[model samples]
Target chain A: MIKQILNDIDQNQAEIIAGLRKLIEMESSDGKATKAQEFVLKELKEMGFMTECFREDERSSSQVDYSPNRF
Target chain B: MNEVHLKWIIPPTDFEYHPEAYNVAGTIKGKGTVPSLMLFSHIDTEAENYFGKFENPYQSTIHDGKIIGLGASDDKGGVAMMLYAVKTLLKYVPQLPYDLCVMSILGKHGGGFGTLSALMKGYTGENSIYLHPAETGHGFAEIKNISLGVVDLDISVKGKPGKLHDDLSEGVNAAVLISYLVTYLEKYNQQMRDKNRFDFGSFKGEPSFILNVGTIEAKGGYGGINQRAKCCVRIRFYKPLTIEGVVEDLSKYLKECCEKEGKVNFADVIIERGSFRATPAQVETEDPFVQLIEKKITDVTGIHQFIHQYHGGSDIRLPMLYGKSHCVGIGPACALPQQNSGQMEWISIDDYINGVKILASILFEYCNFDQK
Candidate 1:
């Protein structure tokens, strides 16, 4: 039974690989202020998942950026 | 049919620097008797420069049975394997005994904001598998756990000006004086190394206490021009070495050195410290999860698995430290420790499939059969 299941997963591997390729093609970079977040949001929503977004406030941002002008 | 519900979290801009970073979570509810387990992997990858050779570093390519691409081995591979495992369990054995939560969080490389934010939103589970490279070929071995900590410090010193000509005793040269301090620290480092002082998993030696004099400045002199000198020092310490203890010891020695020189107006020495330690963890090599993974590998390719430790940090620390859960890292071997440079990085397709199978079997054994 486990072997059959493993085989089934193997059969579906191509689609999984394709999805991953699509995700990487988006070229998301950190702190770039790009649309990658929007892309992720749309992708998840289209896949029938609920989504939420959060951001750090001024106080928290300042605390996180604690290094003296060189972080 | 059993269904897995995935929750996609996208935080607002006010919560993080990269506000677009997202966490995709899917859950398979348990049948009442088993424990809940979370499988986590990051969705983000390191930034690439414009001059990078790869046309599209993110696009996956298969050449010579290796999956070549940015994020292919680092984490995207792990994410795909995790998602597939959960999906497989849901389809083939819907009534898993244990509750399962699979998540692909953001920022595994440097920005831990995604996982940190998720934790803030009250996402908790008892056990987790953090998927990163396990460097296949050494058999199926688990990371057992991780030691995540930080070391931050500053070291500075001041000295007076020396004579312009041949007056050997006029004053101390700030630059030269700072060099002496660096030499002293280096000597201490060598002693630590010789004594086998610091050891973290596979990485060993006392110089675990690393010192980097990142900055130095000096001004002021005796006769006409003023003279002074200062240096910024960074110290990295292994676990059990508190930052405060290191700073205090260095400060005491530095002050004594200044006093011995009889330099009243010498440069000021300043040192600061910061650190974080993840709780230690261990999983028996014979545990069901470990055994299941080993069985899958042997069955698939007739190779025995070996257990190993990771020398660096990973997102494994997040769950191990905060969730207080059992966490292990598993994946395919790409570049050897010292061989592959940046562009040459790649992972065999066979290894990738084998890793997925190992993860899938472990999930079924732990989340399905173990409880029964």
Candidate 2:
């Protein structure tokens, strides 16, 4: 089992790099990880897992544009 | 939301938070034999604050066998690793005796918002792994089981509000008075560093607590001094020091210093605390699940070490705090592509592949009740 798991990861080098690439390009910052989270949920669904998303709380526009100066 | 997190520390919330955003999680059910295992990492990062530092922060590039991007080493690598580990695990150990949960929570930007929400929503496991790279820059060679606490506050000195046309030196400049306090605080910070030293694997007598003055400004914007001269303060501390204790202690020292110096009116000095107060959390290294991960790490990469973290403010704290789980953090060999070369951070493709192997091994054995 150990060998199989290791071999599986080893053989999927291109796919691993591609996976990291996708996440890096998604740009999930400022509490906006929706795109990246969707991608991850899709991957898990492919793996046959029961996936779901937790919605964030509503925030004000000023709160969204928050920076150190505002604090 | 802003009340619970900081502008920078619990932070990452420094940027305006997106409304109606979601934290995604995946779970696989299993027989009621062993406790479940969870894989968690934040998906959000600080905004493109490094705007001019790198060529393209968003683009992932490869150089000398390293994958580089804005958040690659910071945590995107860990997020990818968790995804692939689960993908491979389902193929190798499809018959897990216990459940498996994988989460991509919003990270520091929300000031631990996503993780705290998940924990409150009762989405946790008996054994959890926070998939974040060790800030020590040691990658998978290190694992963090400790969550360092932090205190975030602002300290400022008030001055006479200058007129729009007032010359630069008309009023007792708040900026000038604040400068003296800043110098004193720097010295005091050094002393605190000396007192909070730690000796971990390959971390020989290093200061575990780092007190950083993240930002300082006069709010005058190239004009004369404004009504207040302020700076943001963050202290990452170890156990036995509560946030209130640190705040009260530091406040007292600063007040005494101002009184003794009599440079500026003592009343003018203002120390306003923020809401981002985080407490430390830890799970014993001797816990079977942690040892199992350490063993699998050795089994896969022939490298092992108990790398306790000196700074903390991430998803690593949630499981131990809310789930009562044995948690340890492990990630790829993530670091900067070059040392101070104005380049994006990176993670070794080899180390990343090896990390996948390690996580897969840990998952298989930890959930494989057949072994017991």
Candidate 3:
């Protein structure tokens, strides 16, 4: 049973690698990390995992930019 | 078939260094009579510019066999590895007895606010693995224990009113006195180093006790200068030492000095801040868990386990200090340059896979063993 699961993971290796690559490409910095984080949330949701995105202030969408100085 | 409920904890943005901070969480429920285990990693990294090494440090690159990026090693890699490990475990051991959780929390570097927040929200379990990069090298490196403590002290002295003159003895200089105190502290640090040179396998240094003056101030003009001056000092103590002992000893010495020289006066001292110490455990290297990991590594890479000590701090303290859980950090080695630039970092893909395998095996072993 474990071997079968390992085979399944191996078969999906490409997708997994692609997901990691996509996450890395998002360029998520400290304060300006929202867009990238949103991307991750979308990916998680697509992967059949329940996901939610929370804003620190809930009122300002622009404040999510990953910039240490702005925070 | 038991369905595992996985919840991703998205922490409030107000709690992060960036206006937008989050905690990513996923859970898998345990099978009959199995204990729950959490695998955690931090989603934050120290600013690239702190060490002034890279331009556009956030951009990740792949060169040779390495994944070069700001968090490729420090933690992002650990996060990725944990995610994959869970995926593999779920696929392979579908009905395992243990529950598993993976969290990429925020604010791990800035005093672990992310993990603390998660704990505050009541996310906990019996066993946990914090996926911070192992401090380089190969073999079985488990941080089963830690010495967590804080040092608090203020070094200050007063000088009589005076002006700059050729006769250096005429004016009592607070600045000079503070400078002397700084020198004494430096000497004390040297003494500590000489006494506790790094030995003990895998553990660094003989657990240090130190005094550092992070701030200084003085009152009254000296050397033809205007305005009264004062100084504030910061001290850090190593394991096996307490803040009370440090303060008491320093106070005693100060009193003795004042008695010898009636001119100098001691001011009120306070423990501006304090942090609790995480006690080290006496876990053996050949324990079942350790042996399990060793066998897994040998199976995968054909290399005997190499054990070493960590001379730094990490979120491992959270579970050890708060939850009393047996925790260890295992991950791929990061290729950090001699002088780190947030940009010039990397991890080997092969090592990353080995790390995942090792983590999965450890989890499986724990699941099979009953924690009474």
Candidate 4:
């Protein structure tokens, strides 16, 4: 089973690299992964996966803050 | 003298957080067979321009069979592998037996809040693997079962404008004062390195703890002497050293140093613990989930998977700390800074594809999907 899976992945290697390029070039270092995520959202949506967006705000997802210390 | 007249130092915070990052999760529903699994990677990249500036950090330049860009190896490669591995799984076996969650969170070197948000939003699984390529340069051959604790410290010394002074007890040069503190810190760091040294694993023969002075800042232009100077020190320590425990020991050490200096009060030297402030974590290497992945790695790459207890902080610690999930980290091959110059961060193309292949196999078994 694993061997077959590996073979199939070998075939998709080109597409995988392409997608990776698109993601890397989009630039998300500033924490606003808007462009890169748009690509992700599109890809997942096409795959029939359940997708959701969560952003940092005062109201949502702030209850447990495992924050990094910074200046 | 350039000795500083004591002002005050702000103590360190427990940790830090980001405000504008995003956490995106895509899930393929499972058949309620067994506990669900998650493959996670961070999206955000850091400008770790330690050696030199990474020109066009996001350009996605490919050279000599490797892709060079910021986050290329650290996680972007992992993200790509996870994303495509899921695609391969669904293409080969659509009816997955268990849930598979793929997450791309803002796990910047800034820390784990992006992941914390997802867990809080209830997007976690019982078994989680963070896919971040090894900086150990061992490529996909090693697995991270251990994560180091971190405490980022900000040491600031108040500056006072002044001309040249030869022990005249006049204006305070913050830079000079900080230089003095650096000597103490260096001596102390050497002591730290001597204890808890490692004999095996990825960082063999090196100290389990590392205190690196990453950055120092003061006014740059003219008349800048009066401005406050600050130094950012990062400490990555191994187990048996809790963040608070390290903090207590370090605070005491600094207090003692300052009092002995006498020219500066410990109050005048503020060392703030800014980031990470996390504890070391270990997921059993013998965990069934990890065993399954390791077996798949060997089957896919034909390399004996060496489990490396990373002496550094990672998001794998996130799930263990917050969600109590078992964790392991696997990824492709990438070079570390100072090893790969100009284009500091990059991933090997062939290794990355194989990483995807290995992950695909893991997901198939993880989802209870049978051979077609």
Q: Pick the candidate with the highest TM-score.
A: 2
Q: What's model 4's overall lDDT? A: 0.72
Quantify all predictions' global Cα lDDT against the true fold.
0.54, 0.72, 0.53, 0.72
User: What DockQ, on C-alphas, does every prediction get?
Assistant: 0.23, 0.39, 0.14, 0.41
Candidate 4 per-residue C-alpha lDDT over B1-372 given as tens digits, one digit per residue, 9 for 90 to 100: 112422223433332334545677899887868787888888777643434567776788889998887778767888888888888888877888778778888775434456767876788878898998776677767788887877777788875555553222566767767777777788778888998676556567888888888887776355345446788888888767776567667767777787887755566677664544566777776678878888888887788847576847677876877777788888888885656654467788988888898888888877663212
**TM-score for each prediction?**
0.72, 0.84, 0.73, 0.82
Each candidate: RMSD to true structure?
A: 9.6, 5.6, 10.1, 5.5
**lDDT tens digits, residue span A8-71, model 1:** 7689777766655555566654433234445444544443334555533322211231222221
What does the interface RMSD come to for each candidate? 6.2, 6.1, 8.7, 4.9
Model 1, residue A6: C-alpha shift (Å): 1.2
Model 4 regions more than 4 Å off: A57-71, B1-21, B47-62, B68-71, B158-167, B197-206, B216-229, B261-263, B305-307, B336-338, B368-372
Instruction: Give candidate 2 misplaced runs (Cα > 4 Å).
Output: A27-31, A58-71, B1-13, B45-49, B53-58, B161-171, B197-206, B219-226, B336-340, B368-372
Q: Model 4: how far is B4 from its true place, Å?
A: 17
Candidate 2 docks at the CAPRI level of acceptable
Tens-place lDDT digits, model 1, residues B103-185: 66665323345554555565546667777676433424444344333334444554444556324487555556666666666
If the candidates were sorted by their TM-score against the true structure, best first, what order would they fall in?
A: 2, 4, 3, 1
Worst 10 residues of 4 chain A by lDDT: A62-71
For residues B283-326, could you state the per-residue lDDT of candidate 3 as single tens digits? 24544544555666666556674663443334565555455565
Model 2 chain B poorest 10 in a row by lDDT:
B1-10
Better of 1 and 2 by lDDT: 2
Q: What CAPRI-style quality would you assign to candidate 4?
A: acceptable
Q: What is the lDDT of residue B295 in candidate 3?
A: 69
Q: After superposition, how far is residue B280 of candidate 3 from its true place, in Å?
A: 6.5
